[model samples]
Target: MNELNGYDIEDLEVGMTASFSKTITEADIILFAGASGDNNAIHINEDFARTTPFGGRIAHGFLTASTISAAIANRLPGPGTIYIAQEMRFVGPVRPGDTVTARVTVKQLTRERSRAVLLTICSVGDKVVVEGEATVRTTSRARREATV
Candidate 1:
């Protein structure tokens, strides 16, 4: 859960990276389905999933997307990261037991406003499960130093 902690705006920098890994579980899929109200057969009913093109159950897209939060909190903007925007593409299915890793790379910095543009990626093994971009604003490192 340490990976789920975030930091303030003043403590971020461009080129920072944060990565987190977690193993998918059936319970996670079920819980996500209930919490997100996305009870698509592929994520809930195994029998119904058997008829789908994938022929098996898969995790909800947002469940996979949620993994990015951990990376951002623990790595990118550790304590006070604020989410301004996110764009995600679901590229692959996430099955139970697959260990997925989510990573965020700070791609651009807008120093005047204390904002960062980041590229976020989630993968299982060699296959990418999701990719997207996110915007975060954090306390300026200079501001924190000045206060101290």
Candidate 2:
């Protein structure tokens, strides 16, 4: 697994942590809107968004949540991980130019030892913007060794 730059299931432990960060940009909002087909006014239309409860343009909630995905893929479990389930709660709005950091902590492994359950959180500075849990399966050392 190290050769492939990913964590095998045997490499994970409860409380292990990792993170990824990106600054949300105007282009990111527009691109996400186009790529995801979420053409909502709050994301692309500032004037229209101004009247909404957010008071101005805000990035899509899933866009913020995607940062969490990034942490799981690129940090903790690295490349060979598959999502089994994810539950996210969008707690705060993210505006353009905000530097969002997504962090994942190993909460516990499933009883079967085949999956990892992680506490996922995305935040801007000290304010938590999104929080969740993610269940993912990573390559097993046994499987990798057998394949080799």
Candidate 3:
């Protein structure tokens, strides 16, 4: 399915789902640390990370969180999805070589507006790395049909 795009006030609905998955790699952690300037030992220094509570290198929280964007963009609400807000919590660490997956489900839609409430989660193996809720907007069918 195509990503959800610019929605209208009349298009929102509840119980929608979207998702995407990726394997975390050492390179990904390195690049994220360098780009985001979050050079925390746990994320970039293996030896230093070993001494930390997690006992190994872990990916940045935001890096794992960012996977939600890809999930919403590639699946459920495809091309034109508009992100309004996201509330996320990192429940566990994402180490290199772990495969992470994110899934978003629509929980509610405001009838007066084209906005939907989405519940989402990102997981690695059997552990949940991040979970959250997001508000998004998409164009209504009437708007698209008219344009077409």
Number of the top-ranking candidate, with TM-score as the measure: 2
Weakest ten-residue segment in model 2 by summed lDDT = 1-10
The models' CA-based lDDT, in order, is: 0.82, 0.90, 0.78
RMSD of each: 3.2, 1.4, 2.7
Q: Candidate 1 lDDT, tens digit per residue, 113-136?
A: 778888999999989999999998
Best lDDT among the predictions, by candidate number: 2
lDDT of 3 by residue, 10-103 (tens): 5444665667888888889889988999988888888999999899989898999888888766664555777899999889988899888998
Extract clashing residue pairs from model 2. none
**Cα lDDT for residue 70, candidate 3:** 83
Q: After superposition, how far is residue 9 of candidate 2 from its true place, in Å?
A: 1.0
Candidate 1 has its poorest 10 consecutive residues by lDDT at: 1-10
Model 1, global lDDT: 0.82
Clashes in predicted model 2: 0
Q: Of 2 and 3, which scores higher on lDDT?
A: 2
Badly placed stretches (over 4 Å) of model 2 are 1-5, 111-113
- Model 1 misplaced regions, further than 4 Å: 1-13, 142-148
Better of 1 and 2 by lDDT: 2
